[model samples]
Target: MTKKLTGVFLVLLGLFATGTAAVAAPPPSGSTDPVGNDVSWPQCGKTLPVSPAFAIVGVTGGLANNTNPCLAEQLAWAGKSSTGGTSQPRVAVYVNTANPGHSGSWWPSSNTYANVTVSNPYGTCGSGGGGAGPVDLPCSYIYGYAKAYDDATIRGVTNPGTYFWWLDVETGNSWQAGTQDATALNRATLEGMATYFKGITAGKKGPDGKPAGVGIYSTGSQWGTIAGTVPPGSPLAGLPSWLAGAKTLRGAKSNCSLPGLTSGSSVAVTQYVAAGLDYDYACR
Candidate 1:
């Protein structure tokens, strides 16, 4: 990856840090919190046109847009009105671990509006490398976002609609779905996170008053390969999918490319620009 793309990824993960003193907390209940990070690939910078047609918020350059600013900007775009559609934009927040969860305010006073979204934290790559176990890190781990979200932060939230995404940029370069064709340790870690999400928001509510889905972020070939092959009765079978890729989303053979393949209510948020910004869209 080019230096520019690498930097953009760093900034995107950095958005998760909330306060000065980072702390040690439980991993968000999405993945197993296994000892690794999610994977984020570099793009050629040719992103798709900004659209009001999708939901999930894909953070890009902190363009300092008034209509949107940081997390709020992403939410604003997701909730904006399309030219002629009634689709309500859905905003997503990366559970950033760079900064601590919050201090005085329940939500981090990033000076950004509590857009009801945040991303998971970790260094540029996602895993902190402290690697205590499947997923454990020091309080100061740069990309170790687990510390940012714990019992303390959520209990303090006046608005729990701000869904927390346990995003990791660390999927092995290959899919571990079908055969026992590889690292059981890594796969277990990833599965452990999926188990976590089932309970993360066991007591939370959505912006529209519904249970939110624990997100799984990965590239199509990586996540889809495993998720695609899991049997209907598998524990990880019901998880939601967040496929990362810019160009594929712009085209028709997007996440929904395969027939009869239910990504368990999936969304494809691809990097449209080299600015580390991405946006997801609908198949139909």
Candidate 2:
């Protein structure tokens, strides 16, 4: 999507529910303190106004049909831009995962949907090896591993350490609707992704020495519509939140205190647009 169209869609999404700060919480434990931007093909080749502290690049399309063409360039630029900074500019990846059964997409005959999500991002980032073999599990579990595998391969990360790994959940993307089961499925999908990232294994570990800490990049309303409330004591309940929906830097800052979607997770980041540039506000 073009930046203009994306901006307009975000505007229509209402820039998060407006209100006074409902929660005062410190940044999540083990999270790096830095501002950043998340971009896909739209921002490619455009000069950013300031060097971001980090960047999260999208790896695949909503339906896992295509890989972002500029992921390598974006990653390379992120690496170069962080030179001489207080810390190396962190680079993370996000993937668009949806239900193939209800989202109007046909499951590939040869490759399971989860395998496709993993391979598409991994292969696109110059890691051409195929994904781990398909798991005869729920689609969500498969997708989680698919995303984790792709992220590990792209960064050449070899340890199961903590790093930012966001799942892009938005209404603009394809999703299943119409019943409580849909909500259950959606939650399962997210948990599946998180499970893969946090699980320990000799080969699954990334170079960062820990698994990627999973976060949700969506607003309360969108998440409710897509997956319902994250149940208490669920695996996803304690994950950090990356709040979306802000039109300006001030708006993003104000949103820093909104109630977190995850009960105990800190609201770690807020996304906003300023002067046609997408920016992030890391909650301190």
Candidate 3:
């Protein structure tokens, strides 16, 4: 499905990581921030924006375990981006994320994937017959790792480790809701996915010399509701956030000043909707 964009603009002031004071909203006529578009399965047969400054292609069919039918074509579209003056890559990818527990069609029954043994924080993830619950932190983490592995290996992405990844954590997708345990499990799943990406990008680096691995995409409210508090030592902590919810370019720019999902992270990109399509603004 296409990405969902929702949220209001706040006029509050703030500072960037470099200590530069925040800029005013409704950027000047010749702003330097690159404007790009994001597309996914829902745009399969439709006309996409021509020569976007950058492009974010979705790898899933709106679910964690499903593949986007148009991934290849959309990726090609992304590769053709002009990149303009943006710091973001011409082509980046995002994937849907969820934690449906054992209720999911595919659940991990072991703390391993591709022969790598995971040091699961919640203990060994195994069948309930062996004392481990059918659904636990280890299982959730393995499930996330498995999903990302499949997405990178079987979802048509080439040299998957070379590109940056964005985890799409939206309330529209399946998630364990309602309590602290639910939030922890959900966070475990995301951490598992991030681990896979981070491992593959071990020797790789982005334009800024940071790992070209995993980032997150979601609204603040949705992120808080789904992942709750990210522990200081968690893998998901300190990763950049791609915020959503603005309806205009000005709103997106303003949102760049909003707090990120984690304390050490900041919003590196902000999304807006116009003409029924999703547009992203890259923050410097």
What's the distance in Å from true for residue 156, model 1?
10
Q: What's the number of clashes in each of the models?
A: 47, 12, 2
lDDT of 3 by residue, 83-194 (tens): 5567677778999999987567777778877787876766778885653346778888888888888888988988888888999999877789776599899999999899
- For model 2, residues 100-200, the per-residue Cα lDDT tens digits are 44233332222244344442221222113543322122544444455555654553433334445677777766566775577766676577667666553
lDDT by residue for model 1 over 1-284, one digit each (tens)? 11133333454654454322112223222222111111111221222223333334323222111111233333433344222122222434433112211210121222111342233232122223432222221112211222223311432322433454434332332222334533332333244344444446566655644345455555555444433455454334545544445443334234445332233544433323222334333333
Top-TM-score structure, candidate number: 3
Q: After superposition, how far is residue 167 of candidate 3 from its true place, in Å?
A: 0.2
- Of candidate 1, the 10-residue stretch with the lowest lDDT total is 60-69
TM-score of 1: 0.44
lDDT by candidate, in order shown: 0.33, 0.56, 0.77
The TM-score values for the models, in the order shown, are 0.44, 0.68, 0.85
Worst ten-residue run, lDDT, model 3?
8-17
Give the distance in Å from residue 146's predicted Cα in candidate 2 to where it truly belongs.
3.9
Ranked candidates, highest lDDT first: 3, 2, 1
How does candidate 3 score on lDDT? 0.77
Judge candidate 3 at residue 11 and give its lDDT. 7
